[model samples]
Target: MTITGRCYCGELTYCIESEPIMKGNCHCRECQYFSGGHPNAFLVMSDSTFQYTKGKPKTFTRSDLEKPRTREFCGNCGTHICTKSEFRPGAIVLKAGTLDDMSLFDKPDMAIFTIDKQPFHHLDADVPSYERMKP
Candidate 1:
């Protein structure tokens, strides 16, 4: 399935050519601060299948975890667009909220980094939840 999305200001546009291998909500502190919310959903696509169409995004190297990861965002509105990992080899995680037709993707299968989850928001018990990043 082809999925398309754009940044809040419409300056950055993207297209993904395949179904995401995984989708989930991330509740890590970095994600919370980046999204300004409790959790942010992501659709994981192959890096080779994801393409930026409109403009180049401003990138920030946000972490030095097991893998070095960079976040790409619209410079104009500072909309978090996607996260890429140099160590992951072939994957790109796109911020689901940026999708123009998000309904096209299945509901997220799980939640990750729940150890940092906000205290007030409860998640559904049916989905598998992880204390830290999912493997």
Candidate 2:
């Protein structure tokens, strides 16, 4: 399945030529901060099938972490686009909200980092949830 997306300001665009390897929500503190106090819905896609179709995105990797996940975002709009992790090489974690068709990620396959999930953060009863990262 081909998926097309762009940043909020349309400064950066991307295309995913393959299906996602995983679809889930992350409730980690970092995700909550980036997502404005909510769990981050994401699609894990193969790096080989993803490409920037327009302008380049700015990237950031926390200097404090020994092994930090690299975040890619629109420099102009500050839209969180995708993230690349050293632990999950060859995979790009795309922010579901950035997709042109948001309905494609209607439900998460799982909800992770629940240990850090806030009291106000609600997940569907049927959505499998993990206290931390799924093994």
Candidate 3:
């Protein structure tokens, strides 16, 4: 299936031509901070499937952590597009909220980093929860 998405300012747009390999909700501290303090829905697609159809996205790499993650966003609107990390090579993590059609992807298969998840935030009981990350 093909997936299309763009940043808020429309400066950055991308298309994933292959089916995603993973889908999840992340509640890591970094995710919370980046998403303005809430879990972020994500779809992990093969790097080969991703293509930047519009302006190139600006990236900021987080080096302070054990596994440095790279966040790619639109320079104009500051809308985060995706994240990359050594933990999952040859893959790109799409911020589900940026998707042009939310239903384009399947429901999250899991919820990760529940240890740092906000207690007030409700989670899907049907999806398995991981204290840190799914192994």
Candidate 4:
């Protein structure tokens, strides 16, 4: 199934040509920062199936981290689009908020990095939770 999405400003857009391999919520500290103090909902898909359909995204990777995931965002709107990591090679994590049809992401299959989860972060009781990255 093909999925389409764009940034808040519509400056950067993308198309996903395949169904997501995994749907999950990340409560990592970094994700909290990116999502404005909440867990980040995302879908993992084959990198080959994802591509930009519009303007290029500005990328950022923390040099301080030994293993840093690269975040791609709209340079104009600063809307984080997707993330790439060497640890999860061949997969790309797309932010759920960027989806043109948000309904497609009804629920997360799992929640990761719960160690950093705050009391205010509401996690679905039915969803599996991990203290750290799923391994």
Instruction: Give each model a TM-score.
Output: 0.91, 0.98, 0.94, 0.97
lDDT of 3 by residue, 24-48 (tens): 9999897898889889889988988
**lDDT (Cα, 0-100) at 28 in candidate 4:** 94
The better-scoring model by TM-score among 1 and 3 is 3
Please give the clash total of every predicted structure, in order: 0, 0, 0, 0
> lDDT for each of the candidates?
0.86, 0.95, 0.89, 0.94
Q: For residues 4-72, what per-residue lDDT tens digits would candidate 4 score against the true structure?
A: 999999999999888988899999998999999999999998888788999999999999999999999
Q: Tens digits of per-residue lDDT for model 2 on 43-66? A: 999989799999999999999999
In model 4, residue pairs whose N, Cα or C atoms come closer than 3 Å (at least 3 residues apart or on different chains), thus clashing, are none
lDDT of 3: 0.89
Q: How do the residues 1-135 of candidate 1 rate in per-residue lDDT, one tens digit apiece?
A: 788999999999999888788899889888888878778889888888788899999998845566668899999999999998875669988899999997965677899999989886578889899998777
Q: Note each model's CA RMSD in angstroms.
A: 1.7, 0.7, 1.2, 0.8
Per lDDT, the best of the predicted structures is 2
Error of 3 at 114 (Å): 0.2
On lDDT, the stronger of 2 and 3 is: 2
Model 3 misplaced stretches (Cα beyond 4 Å): none
